[model samples]
Target: MADTFHDTDALVAALSDADLDRPPALVANAHITGVSVARALSAHDVPVIALDRTDSGVAPPSDAVDYAGQVTYPLDDADGFRADVERIAGALAFEPVAFACMDEWVRGFAETEPAGVRLPFSDLAGVERVLDKANLYALCEELGVPYPETYEVGETDADEIVERLAFPFVVKPAHKRKFEEAFGTNVIEVEDRGEFEDVVAEAEEYGATVLAQERVNVAVGADTSLASYVPPESADRDPLAVVGNAAVRYPEFGSSCLVERVEEPAVREHALTVLEETGYHGISESEFVYDADREEYVLLDVNTRPWKWISMPVAAGANLPMAAYADAVAEEEYEAEAATDGPRDGRWVYLPDYVRRCLTDEAFWDVLSEDDWRSLFSGEFEREGELTTGLYRPSDPAPAVRYLTGEFTDREYYCSC
Candidate 1:
């Protein structure tokens, strides 16, 4: 095993020099998430090798060190998918650390690859448990964690669903990806039997099985997650370390649009317990819904890959990407103390939210007083730099330029069902 690289400065210097012979290969999926990872690695001077399916002829950043050829696929074919993985994996040497950007891509890679590849994190079963809504809820039950009251309703047993479950429940597809097209919504909160049947009929169009879960009357807000990496051997053990985390603030009462950090101990304890019970390894984020009414936390779901708010915790202090890289390449075990308590005053507002606040309302003014406005706008706010920001600095701005120009508009690569 190679000696672990501990010094962030040395790692950055070696990566940027362009003279160093060995550079870590980053497998990017051409999604914004993947591009974010690629940019972060690049900022650290690490070489990135991006791969994507070219349905629209879109390419990754031109400044990328080495851009591999595209892997195309039909919308329906399943068998041909393995060929794509084999092609991607074949290009790399032994034990190349892979960063999966999309859920299906990660599933495909895990299912098709040999054990020689150091995936090291979540296995096939763990990924399925985390991604499948029904399975995730079941895991929560087994762990004795609080969750939304849920029951699976197959097509044949649709009539019995209402009889078994209460009214005003949410009907979601068993699969997360099919939520938008099949149900026409990520979740449908039905008030009565009539609405439930209507939703089931709509779901039939996408050929999806549904799960009806009782909507916890708690205030609808985004969930908080703890990001951590569990080793292959410690898959059944407690988390090796918590890298970082983010909390999404929901828009209205549905999905999370705004995200921030929360250092609550109760949220962390429940998240760790859920992860350990599921035997999850790799980079996983366990989510918890804080019920302000009950003054307690409920386990929501776990994400097996870097989520949309992956950069949030990076702004906080625990860098999951760097930890993942270190775990993948290093010989020694890496452990860092879990951050349970800290000053919770700082806020990292998302760019979209900030824009919305500026254009739509006086919300910005209320949040930032006259004195606070100068420091916040001046870039003096302590920002936990993103992984991509660390990799792609101002000295070499080509990657940043290409990234911002929409050269990598191939969204399909990272959003597979």
Candidate 2:
């Protein structure tokens, strides 16, 4: 059968066919973050239609997309967005399989759950807890997990806060996503109380609830991310998860560009413990920075959706997203198997971002401990090997072609972020 087809019935038949161990049908918004989820599904022969919010036309992440609209939260009309989503899915004759790329998108989908659409994430309340930094850190304390020491303030003033904590500390939003957009930074460092007060004042101006915490030096340890799937309680099974050690990332407080699958028992144990405490049965990413001073991995943040590099795990022979997708849409209970000893040497690399950082930011490239400079110089970043490069797939040339035009010839639309 031709991969591209018209008529809703033909598409439905292709999606619903059981003989084809195809990947789950999906509806995800487009971004570099969602690229991994889309690629993972496409590799499985799953029929996926990424929902592009920018409507810039389909990139590789949006390769199979049919609908394009604004998916922003609190800005776009919520009910209208849902209507548009449902209309598009109905026209395509597809039931949304399990996957969400952004937290705001997740909440939007859950709030107005369109007909035939399903998101493989926690309940709305669970999502709130994960999105709220204060709530998550409190949960960590309850679970006896080692989280960064947070300093709460009655006001946005920082004079006393500075005296109480270390001189160079980090202050960020109690609710991260909101603050990230408002401040353009995930975490801000203040050398003195004056800068702290100014940063906090600016944060308050944006109506953000800010929190101050000790900046545990990540000078020695690796910056790691743990992707996990805790199935709904009905499954009564253990959660399946994967850990990646970052080789190169964008900002000290941002997404990874180069990473490799690793087996960190302590990191795994803490993540599972938190999942068990919350009884969370959904997809989550727990970020930890190896604090050399403490000789342990300190929990930094927990993301309750498909992260920026989520596709890498799938490339390394693990399909946590598939487990959630299968469980969400299938009649039978889905038991996710743990990814094994295979692909240990494999690395997930996004060529564009890696090279971008190397040219623009010395601070990030200077901290490349787990990666070889020579390999990155040669565009061969993977320790085992570069498993994948950006969204540059042989079958999908449009995104790469689009990428090149802006990257080289035209700098106006270049995606630096």
Candidate 3:
């Protein structure tokens, strides 16, 4: 049973047009993503209930999760997902915002939207557009967005592929979710032809339909992403999440851990082009890396769901998750904090995780200035903006502690996989 709250009427009134009282948010999946979504919404006084496929792998969900109640549903079972969401939403008498954290969950919710439930995602076609990497790259090509030179290797002789592409290229599957789940990595970088062949063979053995792409030069430390919250009916195209400078502390070469709010016009324009061209409306992540050789940001991948470190934007003055929530429940064209032409700079970090990486990596140690350390640890880390965090929160400290716990347990997760 869902927890009884006195503010149910107010929560229901905000989430949907229905008259019945219910929780305002239905967060599916209970991993880091779900925890983040639940916490973000809760900050806005939105009541949230959590659901899960299993509890063994992820439990003791951050205290923010299960704020309303924690229910179990077979997320893999699409029919079950729709049924469960329908039942829960009906109880509250209004459609709650579906976090829809995973690709499967997003697809499920989008395909069969329970009555009165609002989901923070793109349309079905738009969801498929970004979920399939090959399709996404193809769309970018059509729209003239700069993506790395990508080659689909379909039974072509490995020697031929080796002849065309230089060494240190990446080998990844067309579909990212299944591939990552199976191998625990997004892509593998091979240094030589021999390594490439071996990697492809191993990938194929694990059901990977591989692509060989030129590795964008990141020697300048310019890994960037332009995240945005696109309202479905809004004519305004300003980005809610800007390309605030982002940095990584784990895996050495990995996803961002800390983000600074700043604008990269060319990078931002390229990503906005793709979204507008696709008529995509939702939270989307357009990844790019600075190509020092090309002197431009080269596109990498497009993510439909929230990216790691998304909370950075909220700290930097753009609360995207909330923007999407407000958009979902708005009765009309409501003005929300989507974006501004000016700069909103800030940093969001997981201090312990970063400290662990810095202490262990010689390369990391070489770049850390004394002032940077002092500022970060001394609570004076502002660089004309502000600094948020990955996990630590005084109001709700469990998620931060839980993430750092799991992050250390699987330290190499951010490293070369």
Clashing pairs in 3: 21-92, 22-92, 95-116, 244-262, 251-414, 251-415, 391-400
- Candidate 1, backbone clash total: 13
lDDT of residue 258 for candidate 2: 76
lDDT of 2 by residue, 6-105 (tens): 2333444433342333334444555555556665655545666555445332343245433223333323677866765565455443456746676667
lDDT of each prediction vs. the true structure?
0.54, 0.65, 0.65
After superposition, the stretches of candidate 2 with alpha carbons farther than 4 Å from their true spots are: 1-24, 57-74, 92-94, 155-160, 251-254, 332-344, 357-386, 409-417
After TM-score superposition, the amount by which residue 197's alpha carbon in candidate 2 deviates from its true location, in angstroms, is: 2.5
Per-model TM-score, in order, reads: 0.73, 0.80, 0.80
Tens-place lDDT digits, model 1, residues 1-417: 011221323323333433333335545455445655554455455556555554221225434334443443323343555554444444444345677766656765666654334564676777776778777778778877778767887733756777767677788777766667664456788999888888877777777778887666564444566766665553234443332333323233423334556566766777677766676667777776666656666766677876655545554545466556656666645443234563223234444343455565543333434544444445434332212222233444443444444445643223421
Q: TM-score winner among the candidates?
A: 2
Residue range 174-211, candidate 3, lDDT tens digits: 88756676667778889998887787777777777788
Ranking by TM-score: 2, 3, 1
TM-score (C-alpha, index-matched) for candidate 3: 0.80
